[model samples]
Target: MFDYFIAPFSDYTFMSRALWGCLVLSLSATPIGVFLTLRKMSLSGDAMAHAILPGAAVGFLVSGLSIFAMTIGGIVAGCIVALLSGMVARHSRAEEDSSLAAFYLLSLAVGVLIISSKGSNVDLLHVLFGSTLALNNEALLLLSGIASITLLVLAIIYRALVLECVDPAFFKSVSRFGAVAHYLFLLLVVLNLVAGFHALGTLMSVGLMILPAAISRFWSNRLGVIISLSFVFAAISCYLGLLLSYHYEFATSPAIVLVLGLFYIASIILVKQCGSFLMKRASLAKLSIEQPIQNPSSIHKGQSNV
Candidate 1:
């Protein structure tokens, strides 16, 4: 039994590396996802994930599978989209979502065109889908480093980020950290998505950030608890997904994402039903206690008769 569960990772070096990469990513990216979900910018994160593709594609064209080149390219592309979308939303009459959608769609087309024109179909597949099973020391190191930087930045800016999400106008009034906080958080989002793209591909990277956060929302409303739960959910999904991929020969990234989807569905049903049950029980108890109090004369008459 132990070997059945543990041998795949223990016996295979690649499996272990894959586990480490995903676990680190889960720890760092899940928190950013939580913030994104809270700020109601989940779709924005999805858009930004696509936006990084052209930059990464340009990097690929220049360096040909160089991790650092692609990463830098992705970051530049993502930040450009984010800033442009924000600018358009502010300066023009277009909504933020519409502008982001337009930019990401354009970026995706441009990225695919560049890759297809300069490189092979395989290269295009790599950029769009990623190479999770082929993760090496370099890719792992890049993921770990990004995770470390993300955690540090998030720790330093935690309060400000929360304030900006909760009450942007209040944060602006109290200090000049409003725009700073917003941009810093967006930078963190881009960093996380780029890191995720290395493992999950541009098409699916946002799933790692968004699904665990969405799952946690079903279970808890407290920020700290929700954050912790999101990490736990993501880690569990990674572990299970890797195991499933190993055993079934399924695509690793999609397996991991599909497992997260399962968690989300289960959380919605179980957590919501549990909450409803508890609320009903509490209401029943409260009604029982108040019934006699509201009809004191009837209670006294029954007592005297008895």
Candidate 2:
């Protein structure tokens, strides 16, 4: 039983690297995801994830699975889509989300076409689904560097970002940084998604970002608590998902994401039920305490009347 849990990671360097890669990703990405959820940009995050695909596919076509090349390509594609969507929202009648959806759908179709036409089925699968258990030194370094940069930038802009979410108009009036903060936040989303794509693929990367944030809402109302719990939940899902993948030979990325999905479902039911139970108990106790006092007063009045 001990070996079952320990052997896979201890025996294999790849497993260890994968674990580190995912945990590092969770630290930075989960906080961004929390803010994204708070700002009601969950759908935008998903859209940006898809938007990175064409750039990555282009890199694969040019360099044949080079991590550096693909990372650059993905980042470029993601930022471009983000800027375009924002611009469309400002200049046109279409809403930001609607513009983003249109761009990402087109990007997805284009990415698929490019990969299918120029690359192999294996390449397509790798770009679409990721290579979690097969991470190399380059992938690990990329993930680490992105995580560091993400944390640093977020720390610097945390207050402004929070203000942007809580009161955009006040944020705009008080500081000239509202648009800057919004764009910067979107860039962070793209960067994290690019890093996540190396581990979970373009399709599953948003799951790592969005699912944990979704689950944390059930457990916490405070931003700090939600962010902390999001990271913890993401880490646990990654650990268990890796174990299950090793044991059952399931696809690692989807396995990790599906574990998170299960956690989400469980949180919703368990937290709601617990809250309801406590409320019911409190209500009953209040009624019971009041009942005796009211009864004695009524009896005293009845005796005086007799």
lDDT of each: 0.93, 0.94
Residue 289, model 1: lDDT of 100
Cα lDDT tens digits, model 2, 130-243, are 999989999999999999999999998999999999999998888999888888888899999999999999999999999999999999899999999999999999999999
Candidate 1, lDDT over the whole model: 0.93
Over 1-306, each residue of candidate 1 has an lDDT whose tens digit, in order, gives 767779998999999999999999999999999999999999999999999999999999899999999999999999999999999999999999999999999999999999999999988888887788788999999999999999998998999999998888888899897788788899999999999999989998899999999999988889999999999999999999999999999988999999999999998899879989999999999988998889989889999999
Worst 10 residues of 2 by lDDT: 291-300
Query: Which residue ranges in model 2 land beyond 4 Å of their true spot?
Result: 293-295, 298-306
- Candidate 2 local lDDT, residue 258: 98
